[model samples]
Target: MRVAVYYPWVYLRSGIERALIEIKRRSRHEIRIYTNHFDPRGTFPELDGMGVTELSRVSVERTYSAVTAAALSIVRTRLDPAEHDAVLVCCDGLGPLLTFANRRKPVVNLCFTPLRATYDEVYRDRLLARGGPARPVKRAAETVFRLVDRMAWRNFDEVICIADTVRRRVADNRLFPESKIHLAYPGVEPRLAVPEGASEPMFLLPGRIMWTKNIELAIDGFRRFLRDAPPALQRFRLHIAGMVDAKSRPYFAQLQELAGGDERIVFETVVSDERMRALYTQAWAVLAPAFNEDFGLTPVEAMAHGRPVLACNRGGLRETVLDGVTGLLVEPEPAAFAAGLRRIAQDADLARQLGAQGPARAAAFTWPRFVQTIDAVLDGAQRRSV
Candidate 1:
């Protein structure tokens, strides 16, 4: 099958890029891609190593204008005249344009969640929870995205959600027949080895430093966990890794000041994949306490390295981490996180058992499985089109 995956933008450093690479690797289908972001500066290093045929390379003008222009271009040039077997809208933002452009082809939405619900579940409260005077602007942006999201959902022939929890939201939107929608979770690239015999207790946090990531909560929990631990056991280190979003610079500064030259905490921003693998390998556990994490990549990647994760009990994290098995799941509160940390810290055997189970679990979600599912979906859709 020849499929076109259409997306509004591209960020080379993200999980989406990894998923694309994996799909490209595993699929027998001919895969072509379309994107609105074209950086002549060679910004997307990941794209350098891939074999993707680009349909158009125009830059987006502004928020509303970009969507309009992208939509127009898709309708005009991207899809060959009845050429694609299927069109996979990579995210909610591209759905409107793809649906309008390729009415002759089946359009499948590969989404993490319903965009409208995502705004309500995570972003809305997150802004108000942390935004202070910027709350009104945040709320208005949510409203705009909500309307755009709903329109996009209604237009797609099928929508693929990453978590079971998101299935309810897709159903509520009445987007497609129940059978047409699929719950296709993301998978991690397999790691060949796990680091052994760590002398010191080390914990890792990976992802952007945005308010939604709730790194502040993770930091607070770390502080509280030490307070409740014995002095000898409180010498553990927390490695916070990932690029800091510009919007989060102030918050990051504040967090650094709070750490105040404490030897127990280290902050690393924008590290390479090799460095990330090292962090996961050496760490005692990975922590992600964010709410509605929407198919968290870090936890699964950590699990792939045979490292136990201590994560929030809700959202996509719930689906990724098998509670009491792969890792301990706790509520998002600081005390709960503190307790989870302490539990894993005290039990080396239990941690080892969980860590050992991780690779097997992650193996089931290989890139081949992901692409096979999509190929089957697209094949069926093409048959229907004929």
Candidate 2:
């Protein structure tokens, strides 16, 4: 099937980009993508080779900020069923537009938590969350955006979230019935996540330094874990690696104060993917304590490398990480995370066992499986269009 997938914008080689690459690789269907901006060097280099059309000439800053690009993409990347057999609206800020532009027809929504900034109530509380200094202005903008989103959401014939937890959230939205929403789990490229020999006692927290990511929890938990841990477990260290810039520096400093100059707690401001893989390969376990995460990719990616993960039990982590199997799940609190830290640190056998089971569990969430689910969905949509 020939599908015109709407991505709207690309800023980084994030989970969505990775999913798109995997889909492009595994699917037999012809996919001509639409986006406002495309920078292969900054984002996925593979995107340069893909059948992607640059929808608009947007500035670099505007491309990264969804508040700036949302209206532009909505007004510009408007899709019609006549242009393609089916449409897959899988990108940020593009969902409302694609569904709105499709003339109330069947449009597929591959959601990653329903536009957190626009829909999330907590977003309006802070400036960094909104990406600017205009609170009242942004709220007014989101009010209009919400109206458009609701209208667009009603047009979606089918909706797919990356996990069952997210599927439930989308189902509860009331715009679409539960039956219309489905679960199409995201997968990791395990080959790139090549595991090393027996790992050292190191806990790696890999993600953005945003408040939502809760990097402070990792530092606090690790500090508490070491206060009463066995001598053998003392070798364990916590390494935080991801994009850290001027915006993140303040949050990063807060985490530093929480660490209290502990050598065990580490943060790398300029860590590359290769460095992250190295950390993944050598680490005892991956830690993701993000509260209410939609579908965490870090835990799955860590599991793909045969590394055990100690993640929060909330949100998609519950589905992605098989508790007491691939890894241990804990509540999103300091004590729970500290307890998990202690358990993984002290019990080498249990850690190894969890690590051994991780790859097999992660294998089920492969790119082929993800692509197959979407293919079936899009194929059905195409048939319905006919």
Q: Which candidate is the best by lDDT?
A: 2
RMSD of 2: 3.4
Evaluate residue 253 in candidate 2 and report its C-alpha lDDT on the 0 to 100 scale: 82
lDDT of 1 by residue, 56-130 (tens): 655544344665566566546547746667888776444455565566778788775555423435554564676
TM-score of each: 0.86, 0.87
List candidate 1 segments past 4 Å from native.
Answer: 38-44, 51-78, 92-95, 116-119, 128-148, 177-179, 190-199
TM-score of 1: 0.86
Which pairs clash (backbone N, Cα, C closer than 3 Å) in model 2? Answer: none
In order of listing, the candidates' clash counts read: 0, 0
- Residue 248, model 1: Cα distance from true site in angstroms: 4.0
Indicate which candidate wins on TM-score.
Answer: 2
